[model samples]
Target: MLNRKIATSTAAVALLLTWSAGLTPAHAAPSSPAPTAAGWLARQLVDGERLETVVDQVPYPDQGATADAVLAFAAAGVAQDNATKATDWLARPQTLAAYLGDGTTESYAGAHAKLALVAQVQGRDPRSFGGVDLISRLTALQAPSGRFSDKSAYGDYSNGITQSLAVIALERHGTAPEAAVDYLVDAACQDGGFPLYLEQTPCASDADTTGYAAQALLASGRQAEAARALEWLEGVQGPGGGFRGSGPTPQENANSTGLAAQALRVGGRTAAADKAVAFLKSLQVGCGDAARAGAIAYDATGFDQGNATRATTQGITGIVGVGLLELSAHGEATAPASDCPITTTTTTTTTTAVPATTTTAGTSTSSEPAAAAPVTSNGTRQLARTGFEPGPALALGVLLIATGVLALLLARPRRAER
Candidate 1:
């Protein structure tokens, strides 16, 4: 009897572990990395519409991050419904006024170009979005040197990024001028990479700026400049396949790696792109936590909730293997499961049958043996079977194992007493 009890209990423990291993998170119904990252990003939006930033204890919509989310969504080709909501929010009058400026006192070159790109991605009219001709406004910021300057009372604050965005937006609109393309070409450093702030002394090349600049140059048909920038990016790639922003002591980060990955892929550097993707994947938070699953961490430290939005938004583009120039939304809504290692669990059942004996009227009589209960390790029960897929299944699995061990210990103690 004791042996039979032990066998049954051991089988139960194995069943628990197998169930836990097979348990799939409700939201993560098996998907690729791109869709999974995109889905996580979609959930980060405020009310499924926009991303927000808190300032002075007040929350305000962050248009730039929101635009980035849209771009990420397009790049991954998923979450089109949420992407539509975000794009709608960007097209709102007040949102446009705040982000793109009032058009009378302050108009930002980057903002204008970025939103124009967003509009184009969503198949909306950048010419008349939010009652503003985004293309015209963006073009109006261009200077004689072909650099797109910001029209603001505070300062010009434009740089390589602004020029890149302006060129991409104009190129996509089929109105990219030769001067604009030439200006971006001339901004390249001697090392064949672009700087974050053009005309800055020493012209230090930046990973992020070079990433965007390469894509822009490619879009404008500046193949030579684009090739040089791609080569520079490859040369500067870290040993672990990551990239760093421009700084004396720059650390490899997911944001920079993501941007660089997109550039390398689009620039036809297949080997470099593959390595970049691997680096980005290393920074992704995996299956341990369902809520943060598929989220790309900023760096090696870990998944940071505070900076996750930006990191994830930018990181997703690279993971999806696409740049902004080719981003589009045409994927399904299925959230992806992280590529977690699977541990195959096996269970063995030992059935000990003892013949049934009956005692009646002070006389003992032997009867036929009882049938063995069915024991199958491959039970269909799982966390998903329980209609929940949070963290409970893992905890419960641990508890079950502990209980089984405790049972074994208690059984041994009782046998000794006997």
Candidate 2:
């Protein structure tokens, strides 16, 4: 009888263990046939809308004018001919260009790049849409050592993200591909990964930095280098096929994994690409989530990765470039322009004022009328901007929260008692 009771207890314990193992969350299986670029694009539209919405909320002194101009350009690109839209944006380019002027930083460059991309998609000539100016600014930002700067100071050299954007801009203009490639190569660390910036301090190469580097290399036609970077990334994948931002947090991050998958795909590594695709599919939030509707959540942040927020936008771009996500489906779809026109107009303005003080008693007071004001078009504005639906955001939020909680629980330590 005693032997039989012991056997029964052991059997029950074994059965429970087996059931628990089977109940563990499985890796996200790939959804259907692989998602196409257009499909992925449709999934990733939140980043663009989010960007516009965030910028709209900020209280910059020039916010109104800049927003007006950007929205106009974006709307015109969809409604009017690409050239006409480009002309409208370029006419008031100074509004946004001010952000790119001297003492400008990464955020400015990134904002302009995002705007440029919108113009690109709208079929504007890269040169006419301020792409050339952006290239010049980014080039100047590059240090002599080939690293992009965190600021004007050469001390902080985290060139991966900046270099990635520069590569996009360079490719757009059909110039400086070699320079962009060289910048990416120089920023690479010994471990085949990249750091946020180049510092003397010891820091592990990160998924975000590596993802940007991989994308840049791929864009510049250096598939081999991009492939090597992807190999390095494979080493960093966590237990459940998600990626960590760095050492402190081992959580499986949706955004990082999505971006990593994109890089791998673009680098031409099908095996890793498949894993990344699976991971992203698992993290997809449904359309009703709070932060973003109908888009992939960035991580457990409950925020859509690609919307107007800076980090999210970069992540979205990476994913989109790799063909894993798509933009929203509701926006107006216009045909690409057949012809790009060249239109130029110039105006001169002058003002004269009498001296407030009479240092010279003999000097005569002179009055002059202001020169003729420049004539300009009202430019294109969005008849209706796209809005996010609730279902996608809710679904993405649910996934993000669930995964984040799981990661936290897994990371927790069990108590030891005396």
Candidate 3:
């Protein structure tokens, strides 16, 4: 059970113009003349009035992406009605909370955390959304080391996001997260950007994990660490003001740029944030395809060769600097992390503990975590997470923003979409 009280204090939604004022960098990046992201997104709704992965693929609404779209609307101060519909779709029991990973303890940690944050920003009960208690479920999945993923899934897929989203969701519920920040702090690469998992050795850092980790630390009030991370993360930005995905590929894209942009904005790097926003805007699908005009692309070529649904929704998050840390600023006193450990531990002898096991979000255990799924050789495995392909590919898939980057790199869209 969640050792916290869910809060429901409603604040009048602010207009989009000033939505990012608080997070705007001291040195704003070069601004651009762009369409209203919220209004553009609002036009892509399907007949059900909910945001779909592609409006044609999967047919059903994407709960996680829908939550992201709602938060984006809230951030932009437009399309409250459509945002409301997306929220309603997520709040349905048969949707995000109920169907993702089919109730697995680990599979949908990111989705649940993000959905709870949507409720948090709306001043609703994230714990009792559609009779599903996301806070409690997320809390129950914490591992002994304070990580949130199970071992059975792919690499850092669940843990990194679990840590990031948990900080925000639990705060809205008025309960301090019991997981120690040490796990995320330890996950940082030498460059200060965090990896998909924890590590002690030198490894390359990634924008996605680094962005989420920075946001998680900020929401948790670990400002010093957040500051250091923001610096290292800024180093990865390319000349075009975009950040790269995890791995050997230094290519810039919306998902990574969005994540890094949100992190930089909240962490007090306005110039970096502004530049990232500009880069993402340049990726929006425009003029050519009327059906996808307002949608965001995964990367430069995505507009011509990729699907826009997931990338567009997530892209809006970075563009507006929408995050739980920002939301926490509006509510009453934010929830602090609990002192006692929140992860579960079984009785095992010290000797047997040598080959000791560690658990992840889905209750799956691993013999050796490859010494944490950092940017080492094991890093490649981090890109193979199953379920919910995101990014450039337009596949008929379910939900999992464990970042769509992995999907973009590994899977090709097999089915054709309208």
Candidate 4:
């Protein structure tokens, strides 16, 4: 009787163990949601629209007005690669001054910088429009500690908007300004993200600040540091294939995503770069009127009703143009036809001008015209263009590293508590 009772108990225990094993699979964690194209599309629309509005309203000239018209046309030409139109616009001094005069000193400086970029691309001397002087003023705006202060009192230091603008100015003027990078790096928090300025800073790194920082650094020639900042950026990307400005908000906005993608691409993260491109494409509303299509609206579905501005227009144009350029360079985007011109307008004149000399790393090269020459270093060639550079990237990277280390250290105690 005892042996029989023991056998039954053993069988009962085996049955219970089998039942528990069966329940384990059901209690397992849920799988991560797959990334959706729609989510990416939504982010693009918001960013595209905001960018479009900014580009549209910045007071481009009426068609017949020589000066403003020229600037207006030039601005449009840069977007569309219309060299003929750009030249026509540049041919008129009054229009140029009018367009250049629309903003305060800061905005004018930005306009000149943009013009200088277009000139650089067309193999023209950027200094013709007082580009160097403009850069100097932009640089002068920088505080002794390397931080930039907007002349406007209402400007928020935390946004780092002026600094970003300064980065563009410095880049177009053909030199990487280290002061901005130093200031930004000094202000970096313990996290891989930057606070707007240095106070009332966001809890997590902001997408806008991070994106701008990444651009500045990459343009300045600090690839390794840019890569580090990008790695930190990777952590901020939402599952939706878009990044949030901060916190739990997952609104997939365009400005952040567009800028972020550009930064990642410049930093050499091909996969993430592809994802960002896909996201931007998903946001495209197809070519239509400024109100209907050219404007990058709030969602891929096209619901936002905001007015267009020059800033958005330039941002979109730069992203699409530069993004395509980068992709084409890597053979990811289609190669342009031999007859295809990067600029949209046709040139009426064929002037083979003398080449200007340039000094890089204290070494001067005189093989080609300054406009047509390529500055090569470490297997990377840079055309004289108004963009971000490596100095900011290095500074941003230093900050990111410091922030990441702090985050890890702080996380240790939390894990221990748990």
Local distance difference test scores for all models: 0.76, 0.45, 0.58, 0.42
State the lDDT of candidate 1 residue by residue for 236-354, as single tens digits.
Answer: 99987999876652888889999999899999999999888877766665544566667777776666666778888888888777767777666655434344334333332332222
| RMSD for each of the candidates | 11.6, 27.2, 29.3, 25.5
In model 3, where is the ten-residue run with the lowest total lDDT?
3-12
Q: Looking at candidate 2, what is the lDDT of residue 58?
A: 57
lDDT of 3 by residue, 1-418 (tens): 0111011000111111112212211111112112244555666666435765544444655566667666766665556667666667777766753444545533566776777788777667877877787777777667787776633355436756567677666755665455546777777777787776554355667788889888878877788889988998888788878888866546787788888998888887999999898777666543223344445667665452224555666677788786655553131121111111122322221121112232112122222112111112211212211222232132112123322433453354434321
Residue 292, candidate 1: how far off, in angstroms?
0.5
Off by over 4 Å in 4: 1-126, 130-132, 153-159, 198-204, 246-250, 286-295, 300-418
For lDDT, the strongest prediction is 1
What is the alpha-carbon lDDT of model 1 when measured against the actual structure? 0.76
Deviation of model 2 at 19, angstroms: 27
TM-score of 3: 0.63
Candidate ordering by lDDT (highest first): 1, 3, 2, 4
Could you tell me every candidate's TM-score relative to the true structure? 0.75, 0.51, 0.63, 0.49
